[model samples]
Target: MRTPRTAAVLVPLMLLALGCAPQNSSTATDTSASSGANQTPADCAQGKTMKDGVLTVGTDSPAYDPWFSHNDPTNGKGFESAVAYAVAKQLGFDHSQVTWTKVPFNTSYAPGPKHFDFDINQISITPARAKVVDFSDGYYNAAQAVIAVQGSPAADASSLADLKQYKIGAQTGTTSLTAIRDEIQPTSDAVVFKNTNDAKTALANGQVDAIVTDLPTAFYLAAVEIQHGTIVGQFQPSAGQQEQFGMLFEKGNPLVACVNRGLAALKSSGQLAAIEKKWLSDTVDVPVLQ
Candidate 1:
C-alpha cells in the first residue's frame, strides 16, 4: 500500500474514472435503529459532533494509496479519503471544520474508549472487533485474494483446493493469512509478514509463492508497485469470512448514528461509487470495494 507520488498520473486517471455513471445497487449494510416521530434532530446530525462541533477523524499516519493518496487524507483524492470528507459534509461540517489524527491500526479498535469522533482507515468490521467498538454501516465491502508473481504456481490456482501446495505470506494477526492457514492450508508452508510491503518483497525474492491480502491491497500491488504480480482470485466468504470496511467509533458513542447517516447519504448520492471507480479501478482491475 504505497502512496502515489505523482499527481500528474493520478489526477487525470481519477477524473476519467469518475466521469462514468455508477452501477445501480446499494453498497452499504443497514445499521439504523427504529426512529420516533422526531426526525429533525436525526436529519440535522449527519456528521455533527455533540458539543465541540468539530469532526475529528483518525487514520493511519502514512495511509496508503488508493485509500489516501500521497498521505493527504484531507484532500479526498483516495476512495476512503474522499469518503471521509463526504461523510463529514453530510453531517453539516465543512472540510475546514473537520480534523484528522493518526491512529495505529493494531490498537485502533482495542477494548477501551477512543479519542476521535470517528476513524476511517479501511478497517474491516468483524464480530470479534464488535465486542469492543461499534462500527457504522459498511462504507465498503471487500474480498480477500491471493497475490502472486506472474507464472508462479499460485498464478494458476483458482480455487481453495488449488492453492494448498503453495507457500503463502500474510500480515500477522489478520484474516488474510488465517484464510491461507485454516482454509487453503498450503502444502508447503505459510510465511508471516509484518505488513504488505514485507510480504511483497518476500514474493519478489522467492521467499514465498504468494501473499494473501485484501483485494484492494492486492490490486494496488499488482497494478502499481509490483508490475510483475497479479491477483489470483477472490475468496468466497465462508460462515465467518465476509469482510466489510466501516467507520470505527468508540463503543456506545453517539457519533455512530451520525456516521451511519453520512454514509447513507454518500451512497445514495453516488459519491461513494465515484470514489470507488477513481481509486480502486485505476489501481487494479479487480473490484476491491462494491
Candidate 2:
C-alpha cells in the first residue's frame, strides 16, 4: 500500500532501530574480553635477565656495617642488601629468585664483561667511571666523616683547617681517599689502604692520626668495630653538591633501564627513605666539620 519512497524510509528506520537494540550476550562477552586484554600490565619478561628467571646482584665481600650487616648480602639486613631486594621485587623477582655474588669494589667498574646484572657497593657516579660502566640514579647522598681515636689530637679538631696538620688514611679507590687529598689537603700524603679494615687498623695503631670514611661507616666503626674510635666530624660535600652512591652496571647494559625503573618506584613509594632510616640513622648525631 505504500509508495516506493515510503518503503525506502521505512527500511532505514527499521535498520536504525535494530542497530540501537541491546547487544547479544555473545557480543557483550567479546567486547569485555578485548577490554580486559588491553588492561593487563606490560610484560617485564624474565628473558631479559642475566639468568632465566633469576636476578644476579653483586657486592664486595665482608660487606661492611649499615651497608651489609655481618658481611651478608642475602639476608636483607643492611641498607644495600635491603635496597637490592626491593629493586628485585620491582623487576618481578621474589627474594628467592635473587642470587648474590662477591664482586670486589675496585673490580666492579672495570671495562669488561660482567658476571652479575648490577653491582651496588657505594660506587660513586663519575664521568670517567661512566665511560667504562653505566650507573643508575643515585640511591644515597654521601658525606665524608673523620674517625679518630678517643683523646687523639684529630678528635679535638673542630674544622678542616684544624685537621690539616695530621695524617689521614682511607681505602684506596674510594671517595674517602679523594676527600682527604682534595678536601682536607693534609700536610702529608693521604695514606691509602687496600680495604677499610686496613684504614681502621692504621687509625687505631697511630700510623695515621685519623681516617676518613662515609658518615654511616664512621658511625658503625665508632659504635661497634673500633675500640675508642670517635667520629671527629662529617665534612661538607665539595662544591655544595652532595656526593651520591649509585648502582653499577655493565657498559651499555639494557638491564639498566629496568633497574632504574625499580629504583624510581621504590623512591616514589617511600621505601628508600624507610631503608635509610633503618640502617643509616646513626649518622644524625654526628657533627658537620667546616
Candidate 3:
C-alpha cells in the first residue's frame, strides 16, 4: 500500500513559496497611473513608497498551474507568489497591504502607463526589453532543458547534433522555444503550444518526441504529470542564450532601486538561496539568480 505522509508535513510545506510569478504584459503607462481604492500619487509615478501602505501587483488570468496553485497568487502560496510577498515584506508592506490584479504577459511590457506595482511571470531579462521596462535584481534564475518520453530518440541524444532529429514543442513566445529553434537546431519541426499543459499532453500522445522548457517546469511536468517521461539533459545557453527572471518596473522608476536593494539583501542574508533550494534546485539545474 502507498502510505501517505502525515498531513502536517504537507500542510506546513504548502505555505512555503512555490516559485510563481506574473504572466501578463504591461507598459509604463499601465503602472504609472493612480487608480483603485488605494491608488496614490506615488503610484502615478510608479513610486515604491506610496500612501495606504499597499503594494499592488499585476498577474495573468487563470495564471496557470504549478505557477499559481488555486488562483491565489496573492496568498504567497507558490514560488513566484512567495517571492512577490517576500519582496513586498522587504519593502515594508504587510500581507494586508498587498494586492493582486490580472493582465496579459505581453501586454504588461508594451509601451504605456501601468496599473500595478510590478509583474512577475517568469520573464527573461533581455537587453531589448530593458529599454522599456526596468527589472529588479533577478529573483529567480531559470535554465532551458530538454524533456522526452522514456523511449524517444531525444531521450538518447548526447550531443547537440543528436537533438536535431526530434520534433519538439514549447510554449509560444518563450525562451525555451527560441532555444530549440535557434540553438538546438532541431531537424524536425518545432511546435508551439498555448501553455505547458497542452505541450505535455502532446508529448504524451506521441505528437511530439520532446518538449523544451524552463528546467524547473520541465522537471515538474516529467515527475508529476507526464507518465513514462524523463528529462534527457540540461542545455547551456550559447553565448547569448542565458535567461534570467527579474522583478519588473517602469523604466527609471525609483521603485526599481528599492526592489534591487531588497533582493540584494535577501541574497546576502542567504534567504534567497534558501528559497531557491526549496522551489527550484530539487527539480532543475537552474542557478541561483545572479
Candidate 4:
C-alpha cells in the first residue's frame, strides 16, 4: 500500500514528468547536413566557438566514476572525457587545445545562452529539451537498471511485473525517474532524490526497496558504492524509443552541426564503441526485465 510519504513524492514526480515529457512537435533542430557522409574536418571547424582557437567543453562538477575518472574531466581518462577529446581531435583540435568547464546537469539543457562550445554530461536527447537547446547526433545509447539490496525482494525481481509493488526511487529530473513512473508504474509513487548519491543512501537505509539508474552506473553502484547492492535487471526504453546521450549547445547554435560531424566520424571509425568497452564493459549480460 502507498504511504503518505510516498504519495507526497509521487505528486511532484508525476507533475514534473508530465511537464518535461517529450513533445511530438517538430521543433528539434535538423542535423541532416552535419551527419552527411561528405562532412569534413575543415567544414566542422568553420563555425565560431566559445573560445578562439580552442574547444571549450562543459561537464558537471565532480564528475562521477566510469564517466569522468577521479572527478577530473581534464585527465581524459573516463569514457565521456575520452570521447570529448576524440571528438575534438576529429574537429581539428589537438589534445592541449581543448578546455574543460563545469556545468551542472540541469543547467546544461535549460533555455539560455550557454558558456561552452558543447556540453557532454550524459544529457539525453529529448524533444522537450531540444526545444530549448541544440543536440548533436547521439553519442551513446543507454538503458535503465534497477538496484536493490542483495537479500531484498527487489533484488529477486525477474520481470517488470515483479517490481510493480515495491517502493522504487530515482534521481529527480532524470530519465530514470521517468522510466519508474511511465514504465515500471509501481503501485506507489517512487521516491525522487536530489541526486544518485541520495537515492543510493535511501536504498542502503531501506527507505526504498530499490533505485533505478543507467546500466553502467548501476553496475558501478552495485559493485562498489553500496556494500550489499545488486542489480535486479535492465529494461529497454519504453515504447521502442531509444534513449541516447548527446552533446548540448545553445539554441540555434551553428556549432551543433560541427559537433555532429565530429560524432559521425567517431562512430564511423569505431572509437565510440572502443571507449564504451574500455569503461563500461561491465554493463553487459544483465537480464532484460520485460
Worst 10 residues of 1 by lDDT: 15-24
Model 3: per-residue Cα lDDT over 71-177, one tens digit each: 67876765677777777777777789888878666566666667877888776666556677776665655556677899877788776677788788887756777
- Alpha-carbon RMSD of each model: 6.7, 22.4, 8.3, 8.1
The residue ranges of model 2 lying beyond 4 angstroms of the native Cα positions read 1-42
lDDT of 1 by residue, 1-290 (tens): 33232210111111110000111122222334533224433364643463466888898766777678777898878877888888777777788988888887767878787778788876766666666787777666556767888988778776778878788888765667666777777787679887667788898888888888766666667767665887787663554334567777877776666666666666667777777766664433342211
Clash number for candidate 4: 0
- Please list all clashing residue pairs in model 2, or write none if there are none: none
Per-residue C-alpha lDDT of model 2 across residues 1-290, encoded as one tens digit per residue? 00011111101000000001111112110112222232211134345668988989998877877778778899998778998998888888899999999888878879999999888887766656776787776677667788899998899999999999998988887778888888889999999898888888888889999999876677777767778988888774557555667778888776665665666667777888777766665324566788
RMSD (Cα, Å) of model 2 = 22.4
TM-score of 1: 0.79
The best candidate in terms of lDDT = 4
Q: Which stretches of candidate 4 lie over 4 Å from their true place?
A: 1-28, 32-39
TM agreement with the true structure for every prediction:
0.79, 0.83, 0.75, 0.85
Q: Name the better of 1 and 4 by lDDT.
A: 4
Better-scoring candidate (TM-score), 1 or 3: 1
Candidate with the greatest TM-score versus the true structure = 4
Better of 1 and 2 by TM-score: 2
RMSD of 3: 8.3
